[model samples]
Target: MNAPSPFSDMLFEKREEQAILTDLAYANGWMLDVDGCLVKTTKAGGAGGHAIGGAAKLLDWLRRNERKFVICTNASQRTVATYASHLRSIGLDIADHEMMTAATAAGETIARAHPGGRILVVGDEGMLEAIRSAGLEVTPPDASNADAVVVGAADTYSSANLNAACLSIADHGAPLYTSVSSPWFHGGVKRSIAVSSAIAQAIASVTGVQPIVCGKPSRELGESLRLRLSGGNSQIVIVGDAAPAEMRLARGMGAMGVLVLSGATQADELSGLPVDQQPHWVVQDIDELADQLQRVIP
Candidate 1:
């Protein structure tokens, strides 16, 4: 037999679900912040690709109603244009500007910290391009004069890259930056430690300088979104699967958090979390949440 859900008092009950969702719809607007909450990849860690489900329908409905929403994600493996193309391939029809990514956020953060300055990036081609797109000069990791070090997703990391980053921070006194701080993420079938996190950890160990994260759960991303969605009186709603990252992001932004079981987090994990860390709503998936929204938002 399964144990009772601690959220039983707040969720699934008909009246309470209606009441909460109603208030959510009435808010200034909603932000469907994480990709994992809406789409699932075919392979572990999105190595394969993505597929859309009920979340696509939800997006269409929101668009038809002229509602304000953004599909924000922390996956910084590619540029926003590439991610948008990937979504289009899956028939989701998302525009590049409609999405916010950790890559873009990292770029924006770096630009603000050291505008037009050279940055040593330790990541993949996508991360390098993102930094460049942010209007900052990209220096090779070995560049001794790099003003900062920005770390992101990188499948190929070497000792040489690590050494360059260390030298940049310790010797050059360059600040260290990262896309996301979470050590691990839910790839479709299993959890994997983020390449950026691993590299950041190694650099911090050597230089004794912690990285400033610019992705989810960091105020940087939230502040970026706040600027993007200015002149809004609606409340913000963050829906995602990861607890440590997405839930913390919602808390940091003072937005409503909805957890779906289709991604990283499982129902059993909720019991172990602190009361404050718990999501305000829990559902089986985006489809179920959409159903709830349809019933209450009209």
Candidate 2:
């Protein structure tokens, strides 16, 4: 039913190719890996999180082996603690410390760039807490002394709030930062627009100050993850379904890209990608990927 994979000559069947490619991913030594959002959340989409196939097994194995990996995601609706707890409830053995989120990245970035500065955040309660936890002061939208604007996932947006952000950036000369660049996300039954991007764009249009993104595909998050890794020239592998987030992260970090079909991306989409943008390996899901890793690992 499917055309032979372009990698067939060197690796044979899909299963074999998956194993070989995963092996190659770790060939340089240890691997510093990050997963896409859908790897933990349901592909069908919904308000909460669920473990996908082999998610628990793969994460457990990695933890038991003390492998270097993190579940990096663009979902900023909840705090990292909430997501970690949700994953654990779904049988995935993940800890809060093992997760990297866009909200957290945004907070850290803002703190690094301007410590103790006043940040006006247009996001959920979770995002607000994350920024506060990072040691930056959170200011209300109407605050006149705001030093920066950080946008994250919000359920609602009002023109008044947007105007405040614009004023902060344009009139006050404050910088703008966004949690993620994605325009939308899978909402279980359908794709829903990402309010963060909308808010960011609205303010950017008015202020003409493009946002500094602090999520996946941005080197800010990648640099944070790199800090957690054991010092070495170890190769990294970014596994995800979203091409723009995970694949772009791989290319930026000089890491291998692995695309799983159990999420937002479909098989047909692979053929249309440019060679440089294409993932190094395409598999059914994380289960298949874990299987391949098990076969090659000593």
Top model by TM-score, which number?
1
Name the top lDDT candidate.
Answer: 1
Model 2 residue 202 lDDT score:
79
> Candidate 2, overall lDDT?
0.71
Candidate 2 residue spans exceeding 4 A from truth: 1-49, 158-160, 187-189
Model 1 lDDT, residue 192, Cα: 66
lDDT of 1 by residue, 80-106 (tens): 777777777776767878877787889
Q: Summarize candidate 2's per-residue lDDT along 65-102 as a digit string, tens digits.
A: 56777777676768888777766766767678877678
TM-score, cand. 2: 0.85
